[model samples]
Target chain A: MEPPDDAIPDRPARETLAHLRARIAPAEAASGPVLPLGAPPLDQRLPGGGLALGAPHEIAPEDVGDEAAALGFLLALLARRLAEGPGEALLVLAPGHPLPYGHGLLALGLDPGRLLFLEAGDDVEVFRALEAALQAGSLPAVAGLVAEGLPLVAGRRLQRAGAGTLLLILRPAGAGRPNGAATRWRIAAAPAARDGAANPRPRWRARLERCRNGRTGDWLMEWDGGAHRFDLPHGLAGRAPAAGGTPA
Target chain B: MPVALAAAGPGGLRLTAVDAGARALGLRPGEPLGRVRARVGSPLRILPAEPAADAAALERLCLWAQRYTPRVAPFGPGEDAFGLHLDVTGACHLHGGEAGLLDDLERRLAAGGIPARLALADTPGAAYALARFGAAARSHVPPGGTAAALAELPVAALRCDAATVIALKRLGLKRIGALARAPRAPLARRFGAALMMRLDQALGLRPEPLAPIPETARYGAARSFLDPVSRQETIVAVARALMGQIAPRLAAHGLGALALRLSLHRVDGAVKALDLGLASPGRCPDRVAGLLRLRLDRLGAALDAGFGFESIRLDVTAADRMPEAQGMLGAGPAEDGIADGTAALAEALGQRLGRPLLRLGGVASHLPERADRILPWRPGTGPAWSPAPLPPRPVLLLARSEPAEEVLALAPEGPPRRFRWRARLHRVAHAEGPERIAAEWWRADGPARDYYAVECEAGRRLWLYRSGPHAAERPAAWFVHGVFA
Candidate 1:
């Protein structure tokens, strides 16, 4: 008779909303600490003004050839985390994967002495070591390079085990499956800016493909090794580039 | 069938040992095999004697004999007979009494198909003499009766050489009783101090130390169960309890275990030993238990608990002096906390992976590949990370360089303008350097490598090098060594 007054709602609607919010409050609070990139634009875009620690993060190259770029991005993040504390970082390499050069890691502001390299026997062992290391919580950050995609159960386990540490999973491009990762990044090598110098700084087109509780965007990031910080190229300093465009 | 083992002797092939069938046929050791073959006029199984294998088996038996007493030594191949010496001074009570222990030892050895003569006595020398030439297979000599027990045995039973035995017999001192009654001065003067020393040792006059096998473990604890345990949890729990028993002894000695050995003694006398290596020397039972748990989990189905394990023993095979805990007055909690956590993690990972956690160490070498090495991670024991001013290195270095094909260069000695690597063609848009690195003169690693950092048009950077110099007879070979960010 009253045209099914569902739009007006009833007393139970308020209680349902409160219950949903109550369920989400503990999860948001349990995300643990935040590690800021020290860049205002990037940090502001993140939900907590930084990457959420104690959660799993997925990173993959945009193409097979861009693997080095993806690794560089992950190492940069690891370096930032190491700088924030006095603990070591572990890099677990799947079987048959090449090791990252020590001098290169040093150049990226990561101390080779502070990094532990564990070459796992297979993809399964890689995940096993990653989960164990994360649960140990002795390290500031743990990163693994796997050849296969992460299964859903493993992803959840990793998320659960990595409380109080940063967990990074690096896989090949297009190998990502549904997981509970807080953020998924796609990294691709970008052409160096022509600054009339013989050696230009390395650059990458880092795209935040997915963020669980934050907005996603794309940016051209330049690694300033001397300062140990990410910088925008000289020409694109203040302007926020348009989102969802082909990488230049 | 008659079975005899033959070994090459100075005169000819001689039998080293004989089985029961061969013995019944009147075949004896030290007899010529050819003579036996000609006289037997029947089929006899003659096998080559492996002295080395026999020694190894005897050594393993000595290790197995450790079940009875920690002080067990292998005696052999010399003037003395091949056998084991167990100093069961205080260990005799563990298996009832002396007679019971001897019985159990004989029964077990018999079950293993090993024909062994067991004896218990006050001294190792007396025990050896009784076991070798005694009338019974198993004999027990009462304390203070060593002289009486060894009296009936021949003088050769004192482990003297053949020449000494013959000399004594020529003097009509054939029996130990006769030798002991003879003039001590003449015997000591004629036969030297060794013969008298052996006699005195057997009579308990002189202390004869049994040089037990070099035990790897200094401290150990064992637990036996009435009902065998096969479940993984039970085994881990037993291992933890054993470790708990051993930790206090280790602490009492101010030692920490660097390596541990967990031996699961099955009901069938088979032992399954698992070794765990610690990253840092520690005596904490909980950490040891955690590592053992991980190791057992990794073993999973491979851990064959045949008829279950009746006893579990934990041994600290390798240990180091552990400093006493310093007062927490001036220590930083952050550093200590991290170090402890790291050590625990390393132990877990190491036990699970069956390898040690490694960290990269920089080496003072010009070769890129030889510049860094992965060494086992040890706290406060690696090179400090200092960034050296050097050329830009690649982020990922291939274990082996791959050859590049379809190379097109604008200049003969310049970087290639276009190249194909792994079946993919790449066009170089920007290039830097001919960073010439010469091979070490002391090394024979071919010619120098002129490395170039090339950025391909597809936005991928690569590290390429040309081996040797360009010549008319041999064109320089191009190789892709690494990838860059």
Candidate 2:
């Protein structure tokens, strides 16, 4: 027996099989953690209790005045996703050359150097550029500011190409038409109650228009730019706006 | 085959050019038109010569010759029979060898229905002489073969003046070899210094300075085909290959192109060019090709493949230093601000769309226009950190300031209470302070401005400014500068 084992006795066949199984078996599927939407009510409405990662999300502004809110939401979300891994980059595709200011991005806790900007003349070019950036797979996410009407084919391509990234398409506020997206949201500026402060903190009204197998909800979202997060309340303090919101 | 071109002479029309066919009939340029007409009679074809049209055609050919070398230059002005000089010292090697290059040049010109004679030598003078009067007409004189090659040729090969050649001939010095053996003192005394300089330059004993054309592109790659190709796929394939050859050089220098020009040398002698610019500099060939594909799609009817392109050249006309990406070592991407692959995306988009697209960084300045500047993000040159406090500016500024019509201030000089912009009237619901920005003295002299951030009743934030003073000799002019989101 000593000659057969050299130094020790062979383990039981059953135990050896179990140990080998532990070492070679595939690890759990990549559903590590859900990205918390931060707004307690918004998270509570979704079955997953948070926004899904590796999915395409749409953030559209209600009008010219709501553009800032939609953009701010995208920036904060991108900043958070990019911060997960060191040196992650974000591609920003916009219409025309009216690019976001470096100082403004810096205020949003994003390094201007990390942002690559491109101008798309139309929706076709926008989707073409977005598809390429996603296929490259080097960036944690790509943000596009385009007027919607994206074909379903483009939406499907984005989903397949974006594996561990966030594909955010920001368009002007319009009808919540189907576009093969995993989630669609409408965002607008929510003016805060006037206080004595020179600059009151900015807030937004985020409404979930469509979610694939997920609950639809609305909330008054306040962004904490410094932390690159929204102030998540405990016990779901974010109640739907008084206006006719998503059906409970 | 005799052909002679007649031009106006002092004694009426005379022959300016004679082809071999005309020369066989004892006709040549400089012969009086009446004499040529008497000599050839009715068989000779006499046509008026147009110097202007010939010069224009030669100029066009010179531009087309740029594919061979950017060092092409015209030997003479728009007068006489003009010749093009191409400094192909370093360029010929790409076409295999000097002989190979000359053959290619001749074949291409012949196909274009233009007669050509070419020669290559260490000196431009020798090359010019060999091509013009050598027995072979087209020759390539080896580096040390200049003296031997030019010796047996006629003294006319020395590029001397007509009078000087006649003088040398009268002295029985018909051949350059005989002239070289003549008494140096008397030769200099009689022939003058110009003859000696020409001889020296042709023999490579003296430096012949050549002025090369200014090339905007420092980096280029060219490919010539054994057979002409017309298919769009073939042209695109060649273009992609040329780009592949050029990118390594750019990468070695740590540079990326801001703009590229793709020149297609058609078999019919026409050159078609496509320009692709980059929003941000990058060294990726695939991205460049992608952009070019988009541009080609947009070109549609504009880009006709034509008989086919015999050669394709890719030139990096404008470029900026683009260092290697981050995460090469362990220093994570967070350390490097701009993300990897962003430049590639920008370049691809710029090619598909027209023009370069970039973000503007506001510089702390007094002038509103000067304050908003297009900041360049590259190595060595970085955005200077300014701790100086500044007033808030708008995200989007109008390309040019448009005058605001019908401006009524709340209290004459106070913030605008109501104004009309772009044919729409906006009522001011809230108003901020008047931030005065003085005009730049060094720049153009313009009236001072008082800017105000006004919130309109429709919830649009407008950055309006009043030019000059409200109490000035004339009423101040109002303009809408930008809109804040």
Candidate 3:
């Protein structure tokens, strides 16, 4: 159910080419500050080498059941963010999310002590804290999980402070629309290599919904957890999409 | 008006020591019982006054006044009569002014069914004079006005011994005004250093400080509302304001508060108190507010702000010698410090949830369930969590181990071939080890356990343990302890 490539959104307003270019360019955020996704095709498409450090990156599950896959994707990004910025802490703005399993996060190479939970009352405070942390440029990354989609205003406001710190906003699957993010990605859970196995590494069909200066395409990302990085599924490397899952 | 403590002297319980009350009644202390009996004695129905009980009451009154300033005690020793001395240098402004402080103190004491006279001055000697004999129940002398305030007071108001006063009267110095211009050399020669010392103390030439009880907080701040606040929000606001006031005082002391007591004086005469114990010492407004929020969350709906709180007091019960830890370098504070703003979130979450946010970490004990217990995840907390060199444990652990029924095995001593837990039989597809776990002998009378990690056909891993040794007795009991993800 992807919209036509050039189809205009309902609230079309005046937008300049320079402003649009600035969105993709990420001048200050670019300076080689991103944590590369490791996939050559995705890395090649992303401007500033990879995901912007101080920019809010929105990620949504492709389907309702792909939460685990989306979570794995987010964790991989966070692990990469932490690795790139050593000795820096990761602030998670999950007000009431279930306790993060220590072993699972440990498997992703995250030290349990390095992760801190921030409980905010509402969406406004969540973004406020995220933006403040981003502007402070203290922590390596500030990520929040909001079940409901954030309004464009809040997302855009967060973008202003996204210079030296990374803002990763995890919204629920099927709950994302275009906003002022530098990049937008949709991830869904793929079938495990072994069916009904205990604690198998999750797979994902990660679709690049929008990119500021990068091309939008679909890629299969699998959690190489112990290795602590995301990789293309065994059979798909620089290849077209296989016909099984539908893209949201 | 003051409440006097009268007891039997040489006379049979006449007005032994009259306060403002007997004085206002035109009655003097040490008056003869015969004259009182001839007057309105029979109708008086007087009860003997106990000095110890009166002193205890005065002590309690001082404790009540502590809500205004931490330094509260008897104005002077027994020579100073029954009066309260409050070292409210910085605290009086909170009630408004010296006059405002007197008004609030009078209102609260009157509301509590007690009579009191209050006087504020630059010197304790002046304040003592004004409180007992200032011609008004309440007297507050502005700064630099102590001389004028003391000039009109009689020599008896100087807090000197009775013999000194009688001796001073013989010199025709009946009023402090008459003695104000006297040459100190002549006065000292005639009346001795004691009399001169009393005059100098009363005139603010020498220091006359009160010795407050030791428990008093050097740093304290309070707010007395013109109207009582019944709502929780208003009370919380008042608490924040007091915190604001106290934080600076803590800073001036070159310290931080590790523990604070917020005492709320309810309009209904009940005092509700909340004591906060911070894991770390800090004076940051947000950090203090966050910790307070955590404490307030504990009360939730149980915090009945009945009638309303007439006053809010914040006393730093315990202070830390070191200043609060902050982010010194741009690299920011390490996770353990939690001082550079990151620590408050962890504390806030821990406090709001009323428990630690992390899962059950392992303890050193060998007891199966007791080995791992849920502890709050504080910044600088519990044992460090390092990944085991061996196989990892399960993420989910059962609150209590449930007994497995109809367990089938080749031998009673060996790991189960198949076990039924919660009516579901799990066939062992793969088996791990029989790790022996024992409980502390002195701690509890507990059976030892042989723990085994077995995987079921459905790929679900289970931690099953057998109680007691095998062979001799009836088959040992098998229970499923935890399920691994």
lDDT at B375, model 3 = 51
TM-score for candidate 1, please give it. 0.70
Error of 3 at A31 (Å): 5.5
**Number of the top-ranking candidate, with lDDT as the measure:** 1
DockQ of 1: 0.53
Q: Which prediction has more favorable TM-score, 2 or 3?
A: 2
- Return the clash pairs for model 2, or none: A87-B333, A87-B334, A113-B337, A113-B338, A114-B337, A114-B338, B1-B21, B2-B21, B2-B22
Per-residue alpha-carbon lDDT of candidate 2 for residues A52-139, written as tens digits (9 for 90 to 100): 6556788887675567667767777777766666544444454543665555455455655555566666777777777766776666
Count backbone clashes in candidate 2: 9
As for DockQ, the candidate ahead, 1 or 2, is: 1
Docking quality class, candidate 2: incorrect
The pairs that clash in candidate 3 are A24-A212, A24-A213, A54-A162, A54-A165, B356-B376
TM-score of 2: 0.57
Between prediction 1 and prediction 2, the one with superior lDDT is 1
Model 1 clash pairs are: none
Residues B361-422, model 2: lDDT tens digits? 55666765665456543322234434322345554567678899788886878898998988
List lDDT for all candidates, in order.
0.83, 0.70, 0.68
**Model 1: docking quality category:** medium
Tell me how far the alpha carbon of residue B154 in candidate 1 is from the true structure, in angstroms, after superposition.
Answer: 26
Give candidate 1's error at residue B303 in angstroms: 2.6
> All predictions: root-mean-square deviation over Cα?
16.4, 17.8, 19.0
